[model samples]
Target: MQGILTQITALLGVTVGAALIAKFLRQPIIVAYIFAGIVAGPLFLNLVHGEREIFHIFSQLGVILLLFMIGLSLNFNYLRRIGKVAVAGGLAQVIFTGVIGMGILRAMGFAFMPALYLAVAITFSSTIIITKLLSDKKDTDSLYGRHTVGLMLVQDLVAVLLMVFLTAQGGSMTISSSLIRLALGGLVFIVGVTLLARYILPPILRRIADSKEFLFLFAIAWCFALAYAASRFGFSIEIGAVAAGLALGSSTYQPEISARITPLRDFFLIIFFVILGAEMSLAAASTVFLPSVILSLFILIGNPLILYVVYRLMKFSRRNSLMIGLTAAQVSEFGFVLLFIGRELGYVGESEIASFTMVALATIFVSSYLITHNGKIAGAVQNFLAKFSEENHPQREEKPPVYDAWVIGYHRIGWNIVQVLKEKKRSFAVIDFDPTVIEHLTKEGVPAYFLDVSDVGLLSELPLDRARLVISTIPDIQDQVTLLKHVRLHSAHTVIVANAPEAKFMRTLYEAGADYVMTPHLLGGKWIGHMISDGKASRAAFRKLKKEQQEEIRSGMPVQEL
Candidate 1:
């Protein structure tokens, strides 16, 4: 216990020193953490040698917390809509990468089973690195971010299934029976977790939320309990922890729970990454290094290409597709964990695991840089990549024949404007990327679509020439700029309305040819002032507005009420 405490202190000191250096250099903190690990690990100063087991336990906790948070935020509806794309893309990448990796190994004179295991290790991207980097870039709210998150979830599901398959293969059961049991077990696990999230967990969290200390302890306890249960039931501990967190998501106390647990997650997660770095030393790197380099390049470049193709095929804009493509340019944490487990099962060797880990770390470092400077990178490559969307590419519907005014993003202001347009007998259609929103719009007999406005293909298909006005409620400056530029090119007379969160950026957008920029905050204040001026801020008037909102929602008109 004394030795462990001393080692932890040394580890933290090393980490803090490295973090300070990274901060000074204006680099991501993860680089510092890995460097710290290399410094303190047995290969170097050996400050954290005997305490490796303790760190590993914490590392596992970090993985659980990370997965749990991911599960908590998954949009089930969105998942269903992109289910086919996600599954097909994720599975294809896994199979293709695995096969290619294995083939390369066999061609190099390695045995079949070892080569197969090595390939499986290369098939996943690091979820931890990807998510952390995305968060750092504040891209979590963007379409690309959302889609990337969904893709990772799909990959996670695939990895879990693979784990189950591997487990079953090691057993005496027939293949068919094993498959059936795995399916049933997974179904039961998912349903149980869903039920726990939706019902049983809420009250427990509610009762304990008032106590910070208690909530922290409870979160840890719940994580361990679920992990233990999952392990006993032949499920991965990471899956169990995520399931546990997802189960708690239905609770109103989730935000509080998450807030309380974040620091703990971070601390443990640092240990996890550090431990990962420590485990990087392998004897057979002389043989595996070349193969690892080849596979890493394949993952970093090829995976994004596949995603780009899929998005293009789905009629998405080249810009969004490219941006989203850049997000998947590394193997996931699941890849590392899967490889580790496979190694433990004696299916994969330590050398293969190390090679894959090194590739993951290298690609992740590059991915972080790419994502951080994505805009600059995209701009640099835009002209060269333009050919990808050229003559051979299906032309975008740049003009709609019927609609006089097209509104994108039918939320609060958009819905109100739609009502006014209807009263004025203006022909209009709503276009949104959200399938649920599109479905609700359809139910209201309003022409709507699950199409991203930023997608070049979708833009090419749009009847922008017929539209007298186009109002976009999406507050992305880049998307707004792109839309405005396209509108000017396609229809000189079309009025383009876009949103900006800040007045300064709004002015910039207007100068860039936006007919008007809606600053939601400023507009809200103006509306509130107008209401006060007209004496419409009274209780009765407020009640009337509330009633109208409820009615609109009931009538399948999706509006932001709160």
Candidate 2:
């Protein structure tokens, strides 16, 4: 125990110093943790000692807490909204990556089972790392961020299912029986937890809500309890942690619980990264360096491309697709678990494990940098995409229609605006990437282009010179800025209205020459203030507001974070 304590102390000291340098150098803190591990592990100072198993147990806390917080962020409403997307995106991504990657590995001379296992492992991206980075940027509430989170959740679920089957193959259990048991156990587990979350915890939480200490303790206990309960049902503790958060996600105190637990998550996560780093040595890296580098390149580049294709097919904006896709460029913690399990089952050997370890370290390093600088990277790629698009598609020959007003996006607020425009009998057209919206509008004889806003050459063809007004409802600030500049440059008389998610961005829009900027929360607050201006809201007034909101909601797509 004393030796373990001393080892931990020394590791922490090295980690803190390395993390400070990483921060100072503007690198991701995760990178610093890995560097610290490499220095402290047997390859260097050899400060990582004591029970190795204990370190793994400790490192796993960071993974659990991160998942828990992600679950907390996924409020009930978002969960319902994301069900279809997550299922489709997650399954499609896995199948594509696994099959294609396995083929590539086979071509590279790996045996079938080893190739299949590695391919399976590569399909998972680190949910913990993604949530951490997104949280740091306060982008968890953004549309792409929401999509990425949903995708990661699907990946994690897939990983769990794969592990169960893989274990069954290695043990006495028949595959069919194992799957049957898993299905039943998982279903019961989910339903039971959902019931507890919906019915049991709310009242108890409400009662203890006032005491900060009590609430914090309850959150921790709830997280750990579910984590233990999850293992009994064949689910991973990470899943249980997420379930715990999902239960309380709808609570008013989610923000407080999340905030209080963040510091602990950070610390444990640092330890996790360091331990991952320490597992790699110069000898291990050198032995399988070529294959590791090849696989790492595939993960860093091909994973995002597959996801990019998925999002594009779903009619998301190219920029949005690329941004979210890049978040999947790293191998997940589950990938390591799968590889290690394969080693234990004798499906793989030390050489395979070492290669994958190098791949993990390499992919994590590059992908972290990619995620942190995704905006700039996506923008650069968007330009390349545009160049290819022009070479492939013919230039538009039809003269662009002239409209008095233009709606830049056709979802949520933009949908409402189109309704009002129709009521007023104003000549307006919608420009959006949503094929469904475009198809609907086209069927109604309203001009709507199924187009990406980032394609400048195409947008420039629009008759902005005759536009009386332009309203942009896209969520990306860069896209909004581009439209603002284009409209401002073309016609000074056009009154441009833009939407911002918050007040701070309103100023940026206004500075870019927006005549009126609508921020939903700000306007909602003002409307709310109007309601209570005469004192508490009357029952009649509340009912009227409710009806109006329902009617408004029915006018557009379902409510989403964007």
TM-scores for all predictions: 0.65, 0.69
The lDDT of each candidate is 0.72, 0.82
RMSD score of candidate 2 (Å): 13.2
> What lDDT score goes with residue 431 in model 2?
85
* Best TM-score among the predictions, by candidate number: 2
Off by over 4 Å in 2: 387-562
TM match of model 2 to true structure: 0.69
Query: What's the lDDT for residue 558 in model 1?
Result: 55
lDDT of 1 by residue, 362-429 (tens): 78777877777776776787777787575244423322257989887777567778888888988888
Each candidate: RMSD? 11.2, 13.2
Cα deviation of 478 in candidate 2 (Å)? 40
Clashes of each: 22, 0
- Cα lDDT tens digits, model 2, 1-562, are 8888988899999999998999899998888888999999998998877678889888988888888888887777878887898889999999998998898789889998888888898888888778888987767767778889999888878887888788898899988898898889899999999899988996787676656678779999999899988988888888899889899887656656776687888888888888988877456667777888888888888889999888777766777778888988988878778988898887777777778778878888888888888989988878777764332322222244689999988876887888889999999998875545655687777877654566554466468658999999888877888888888988899999998977789889998889999988888899889878967589988888789988876765447624
